[model samples]
Target: MNVETTVADSSLLRQRAFVAFWLARTCSSFGFQMFSVAVSWQIYSLTNSALALGMIGLMQFLPSVLLALPAGHLADQFDRRRIVICAQLIEWGALLALVLLTLFSWTDKTALWGLVFVLAVAKALEGPAMTSMLPSLVPPAILARATAANAVGGEAAVIVGPTLGGFLYVAGPDVVYSVSAAFYLLSLVLIGRIRYTRPQQPRLPASLSTLFAGIHFIRARKDVLGVISLDLFAVLLGGATALLPIFAKDILHTGPWGLGMLRGAPSIGALLVGLWLSRNKLEKNVGMIMFGSVAGFGVATLIFALSSQLWLSLLALAALGGFDMVSMVIRGSLVQLDTPDDMRGRVNAVNAIFINTSNQLGEFESGVLAAFMGAVPAAVLGGVGTLVVVGVWMVLFPHLRRRQKLENEAAQE
Candidate 1:
C-alpha cells in the first residue's frame, strides 16, 4: 500500500478534530508525567521523608475511587467536550498554583500537597469524560485504529514523561513546573481549537441508580466484564514494576539511572507494539490474540522475575510491555465501540477504576508481598498468578474467547 494513500485514509491523521485531540492528549499526558516527577521530588526534597513521597500516590488515588462514579455520571449527563475542557482548566489552575508555590520558595510542603490533591481531583474527572469523548470524534470503522494510535501516543508519553521531568528538575522545581505548565497550556489550546462536531444528547438526572448504571451495565455484559476483569486481576497479580528499583540496586547491581531505564522499559515496549498496531489492523480472532498476549505478558514477567542478568531482565520487561499493548488495544476498542453513546462515560469510569486497581493497587500489592517474601519471590509469585489468571479467564468467559473480530462482529450485529 502506498504510504501517502494509507496516511490519507487514516482518520487520526486526516481529520483535523482527531489530530487536535490526539495532540491535546499528548500534551496533557506529558504535562501530567512531568508534573508528577516535579511534585514527588519537591515533596521529598522538602520533608526528607519517604512516607511523604508515598502519600503522593495515595493522594492521587483517593479521588479516582471517590469521584469516578459521579464523574462518569456527569460525563453521560452533560457535554463530554465541555466536561473535559473544564476538567483540564481545573488541572491548569492546579499547575498554576504549583508554579507560584515553587517560584516563591515556600517552606510549607503541606500546601503543595494540597494542590497535588486538587490536581488528583481534576485528573479523576478528566479520565472518563476525555476518554468517552473520542468515539464521538470518528466513525465506527476507524475507532479501532484510532484507539491504536492513541495507545501509541499514550505509551510514548508514559515512557518519556519521567525522563523529561527528571531532566527538567535539575534546573529547579520552578523550571520544571513552568515547563509542565506550558504543556498544559498548549493542550488546552489544542483541545479548544477542535471544531466540536459532537452533537449534544439528552441526559438523565444525576441519581443513585444513574451512578450505579455503569456497574449494572458491565455486570450484565459478560464479554465486557470478562475483558475488564481479566485485565484487572491479571495485571493486579502480575505487576512487578514497583520492585524494579530493588532489582536495579540489589539484584542487578545497577544504579539509580538503571532504575529509571527499568521503569521505562515496559512503556517503551508497549510504545513499539502500539505503533505497529496503529499501522496494521486487527481484523481476526481478537479475543484469542488478547488471551495470548496476556499469557505472553505473564511469561515475560516470570522471566524478568527470575533473571539475574540486566540484559535478560530488560528483554523480559520489553516482552511484558509488548504483550500488554496487544491486550490494551483490543480491550480499549471493544469497550468504546460496544457501548452506546449515552453509556460510554459510565462504562469508561468503571474501566478507569480497573486500570487504577491494576496499576496503583497492583503496586501496593507487590510492595506488600515483597516486604513479607523477598522481592524476587514476590515477583515470581505475581508472574505465576498472572498465568493462572489467563488460564481461568479463558475457561470462564468463552464468549470473549469466541469473539473473532471486534469490528466485523459489530457489523454482523
Candidate 2:
C-alpha cells in the first residue's frame, strides 16, 4: 500500500516546486506564443515584404546564438530559479513596451521589432536555466511523466495563446500585448514563489572556457550531438511555422482566424500525444522511435505544403505535431537523464541553440526562399531536404540507432 501510494503521488503536480515550475512554464509559453502570432501579423501588416518577415527570425536568432554560452554560464553560477525570475521580469517589461507602443498607435515599425529583439534577448538568456531547472524539481522515476505533463500544458498554451492572440488582435494589437504582459507578470510571480532542489557543484568563473563548456561537452558526447543535430537540420528544413501568415492570407485566403486554427492544429495533436506519453512512458527503442517521429514530421509537412483544403491542411499539421511530440518527449527525457546536474545547464544551453536554429533560423530560411521561388516550392523543397537529413543521420549515427533504452545510458560525470 505504501509503495503504491508513493508511486501514485510521484506525478509532478503532486509536488509543490514542480507545480510552481509548471505554472511558470505554461504562463510564459502562453505569452510567448501570443507574441509570436502578434509580431508575425503586425510585421506583415506593416510591410508585406517576405524578406522583412525573414528579418524577424534573424533578429530573434542572433541574440539566442550570441547569448547561449553566457546564459549557460549564468545558470551554472547562480540559483537557477532566481535567474529564471529575473528573465521573466525582463520579458514582462518587454511586453509592456509592446503594449505601450501599440496603444499609442506608433508608426515607427522598427521600434516594434526592436522591442521584440529585446524580449528575445531576455528569453535567450533564460533558456539554459529553465531547461536545467526541471530535473531538480522532481524525482527521476517520474521525470518522463512530469515532462509529458509539462508538454501537455505547453501545447495547450500553444493552442489557446495563438488563437487568443489572433482573435484579440482583430480587436486591436493593444489588447494582445496587454494580455501577454499580464501572463508574463503572472509567470514571474509564480517562479518567484518556487523553492527547488539545488545540487552542490563547483561554480565556474565567467571565462571563455566556462562559457564554451557546453560546446565542449556536446562535442564529446556523440549521442547528444547526433540527436540535437538531427532535430536542428530536420526542423530547419521542414519548419513552415514562420510562413504561417503568408499561408493563411495568400494560400488559404482564410485570414487571421484561419491562421490561428492552423497554428493550433499542431498543438492539439501534440497535446493528445503528450497525454498519452505521460501514461505509457518509453523504456525501449527510444532512438528508433525518435528517428521515426522526425521522418513522420517531414511526411506530414509535405502533405501540409501541398494541401489547399483547410481540413486537409489542418489534419496534416496535426500529424506533424503528433510526430513532433513523440520525439520531443523522448529526446528531452534523454538529455536530462544522460546529463549530470552540474553540466546540464551548459549542455541544455547548447541544445537550445540547436533547437532554436530549426525554429527561428528555419523561419528565416522559409521567408528568404519564399521571396525567391514562392511559398509552395520553398515548403516542398524543405520537406525533401528533411527526408534527406533523416537518411544521412541514420548512416552517421549508428550507435544512437542501436541504443535500446533510455535507462542504460550513464549520467555525465
Clashing pairs counted in every model: 0, 0
Give the alpha-carbon lDDT of every model. 0.86, 0.84
lDDT (Cα, 0-100) at 125 in candidate 1: 92
Model 2: which ten-residue window has the lowest total lDDT?
A: 404-413
Which candidate number would show the highest TM-score if scored against the true structure? 1
RMSD of 2: 3.9
What are the per-residue Cα lDDT tens digits for candidate 1 across 1-413?
Answer: 99987877665544888888999999898999899988988888889999998788889989998999999999888877788889889898988888887787763678877998999998899889899888888777777778888888888778788779989899887787888888889998988887664556777788889998999998888888888999999889887988998999999999987887888788889888888887788877989999999999989989999999999999899889989988998999888877888898899999998898789879889999999999999999999999999999999988788898775353221
Predicted structure 1, TM vs. truth:
0.93
Residue pairs of candidate 2 with colliding backbone atoms:
none
Misplaced by over 4 Å in model 2 are 1-14, 36-58, 97-111, 169-174, 240-260, 305-310, 364-381, 408-413
* Each candidate: RMSD: 3.5, 3.9
Candidate 2 lDDT tens digits, 1-413: 69877777654444877888888899999999898889888888999879878788778888998899898889888889888888888888988888788787773568877887898899998899998998888777678788899999888887788879989899888788888988888888888887675866777779889888888887877788788898889988987766788888888889777987988889889999999988786777888998899999989888988989888999999999999999888788777877778888889998887887668778889999999999998899888888899889988988778776765364332
User: Could you tell me how far off, in angstroms, the CA of residue 256 lies in candidate 1 after the best superposition?
Assistant: 1.8
Q: Which sections of candidate 1 miss by over 4 Å?
A: 1-14, 408-413
Q: Residue 305 in candidate 2 has what lDDT?
A: 88
